[model samples]
Target chain A: MAQRTLLNQLIEALRCLPGVGPKSAQRIAFHLLERDREGGSRLARVMAEAMTRIGRCRRCRTLSEHELCGLCANPNRDPGLLCVVEQPSEIVAIEQATDYRGQYFVLGGRLSPLDGIGPEDLGLGLLEERLREGLVSEVILAISPTVEGSVTAQYIAECAAQGNVKVTRIAHGVPLGGELEYVDGGTLALAFTGRRAL
Target chain B: MAQRTLLNQLIEALRCLPGVGPKSAQRIAFHLLERDREGGSRLARVMAEAMTRIGRCRRCRTLSEHELCGLCANPNRDPGLLCVVEQPSEIVAIEQATDYRGQYFVLGGRLSPLDGIGPEDLGLGLLEERLREGLVSEVILAISPTVEGSVTAQYIAECAAQGNVKVTRIAHGVPLGGELEYVDGGTLALAFTGRRAL
Candidate 1:
């Protein structure tokens, strides 16, 4: 057996990236070695630091280098309005696309009993404690409309109700720029059922 | 102004990868942090070492940590048949898909005078010296059929002619398993002109 070179090792390691297959990994490796050595070096340094240093924010459970994420630490953000999401990336998506000025709670994933993801796994007990603290006026569900997501949202809504906090969900329907014909049946039905007087 | 977190910095740095835009960078960062920290750390360490240590092979100009690339150092490879390619990745492609056992020379790129690339820049002088040493009996051009590729191939063929060595090129045509209707015009024309006795 021929010894694998450093070039081969770099290519193999690059396969760890999501969506990068064998061909793409090889291409990325050669591209870095040939044209972007500086970029590759910087990526290595930053990636190493991020892998070791980043931990979940104690308050919101979002990825952060410190105890609290920047959003959780910000006094300007509304503590009275808590938005719940399934993943940290969803927080980024909401932040980029919307003007919502509220605090967030990351569930990490939807509740699935077969997968053993209980309320404790999602830190729901901590969320209930925050709700019981009495600062929160409203709890918003930005979770997906899947069965597991619905169960998770329902469970959280009940927890908020016990604390006498109002609960609402972000509207789900045909997206803003979507054509009605192209929208899926479930979304179109939701759009019709949720329609208000015009 | 809010301070950028290490997570954001990691996302930004990840964009340096070819074909990875903002969304993909964000996805990869989150994926590594959430699911594959071990793979991410290994990638970082290997990537750093490869970037800092790997250099061009003295003989073939292919990427290597040692002075000579593995293929160049291998005693089993035929020194009499020199196969020239435009990039180091092309060498890997040929090695995987073909059974031809011969020496390889990576030109790094074809002669693009508009981009200030010349013969010396491609290590063509070293190639010429090797041909003149009387050991190599055949020189094979596996370069692309672009205008610059043709010019480079023609120049190398002339160098071999001057040394009284046999020169050949890899055939270009509709690829194996390609449909005739989908094959492009230039390639179809080449296929017709290069048709062999069957």
Candidate 2:
């Protein structure tokens, strides 16, 4: 049987996602066709709306439907304490942990010289400008423990030092409830190096 | 920050796919937002249009945007040679293979007594009505080789025995280039049992 023209178009459009292959795109398209008309329409509407309305926060570069994101607009959040993360999803994870009560600065991505991703790509200039305002007292580097993340953290720390702001990287050690036997060598070494007096 | 009403609505709507969890749905929604506004709108339009127009063909039970599916409508297809399959996707697979040039009859599902699925649930009455029309020469059973598939095949074979038409089942054997070591026990057993003289 010939594929429906509209169905084919939908499948082609869904192929743009990072991990979605052609077969998966086709299946998703068929699923949308079989069910979820209301959901599909809603998704389309929101997709267009978000693209048109949402922009990076002026101070933090986090996605916001307004002038600033919710975290930046909150009066209860500590203006002097800032946690820096790599992406918006990291903000969700940190919020889920619920231990930090500070504002966030989303770097958008880490430094990758090989990939030509640099300070300009991550809005580091905006970050430097925010630090210059002298509202932030401490900048916590909550970025991933990758080499690229370390480079970005170091660069940010150097920039923050110029503004006389104390910069500290998040503690690295065995994760909570992680078995010592299962921990990798590098993490185990870091855990040993960062050990505290009881 | 409060989730935008439209964004949350879009995320909730995109969770209808078979394997898409909430996080993946959110990612897809955001991706559509970041790019592909026109494509997403087109997808929505197609989904709504296809759902409203596509329905089961009255004669063969295959998906049809018109009165009959392409297979049933094509004059080149042998109307007397009908291949029965478990789902609409199977028809697409067979069409892609281009090995079968006959019309099709979609069972919609197999007979699974344990799951409360029976002959009536699979549109067996319509199948019987078509078989009695006296124009059909051969009925090829192309359902899966599962226990349920066997039951359905047996039922169809019994019905064909009472009529003048010949009923045949697709071969169950090692696939081309398939190693014997990788073949499942059930398939190997079926292949052994169905072996023919040279």
Provide a comma-separated list of chain B TM-scores, one per candidate.
0.97, 0.93
Compared with the true structure, the alpha-carbon lDDT of candidate 2 equals 0.80
Give the C-alpha interface root-mean-square deviation per candidate. Answer: 1.4, 3.2
Q: Write the per-residue lDDT of candidate 1 for residues A98-193, one digit (tens) a residue.
A: 999999999999999999999999999999999999999999999998889999999999999899999999998889899999999988998888
Indicate which candidate wins on DockQ: 1
TM match of model 2 to true structure: 0.80
Docking class of 2: acceptable
| Model 1 per-residue lDDT tens digits across residues B47-140 | 9999999998898888899999999999999999999999999998999999989899999999999999999999999899989989899999
* lDDT tens readout by residue for model 2, B1-198: 676545566677677765888888778766665556556665565555665676778888876677877778889998789899988777778888867888888898889989999898888988988889877889999988888889999999888777777999989899999899999898899999999999
How many residue pairs clash (N, CA or C atoms closer than 3 angstroms) in each of the candidate models, in the order given?
0, 0
Q: lDDT per residue, candidate 2, A136-175, as tens digits?
A: 9999999888899989999999999999999998899999
- The residue ranges of model 2 lying beyond 4 angstroms of the native Cα positions read A1-4, A30-54, A111-120, A145-151, A173-198, B3-10, B26-45, B112-121, B132-135, B158-163, B173-185
State the lDDT at A179 in candidate 2: 99
What is the TM-score (0 to 1) of candidate 1? 0.96
Which pairs of residues clash in candidate 2, taking residues 3 or more apart in a chain or in different chains?
Answer: none
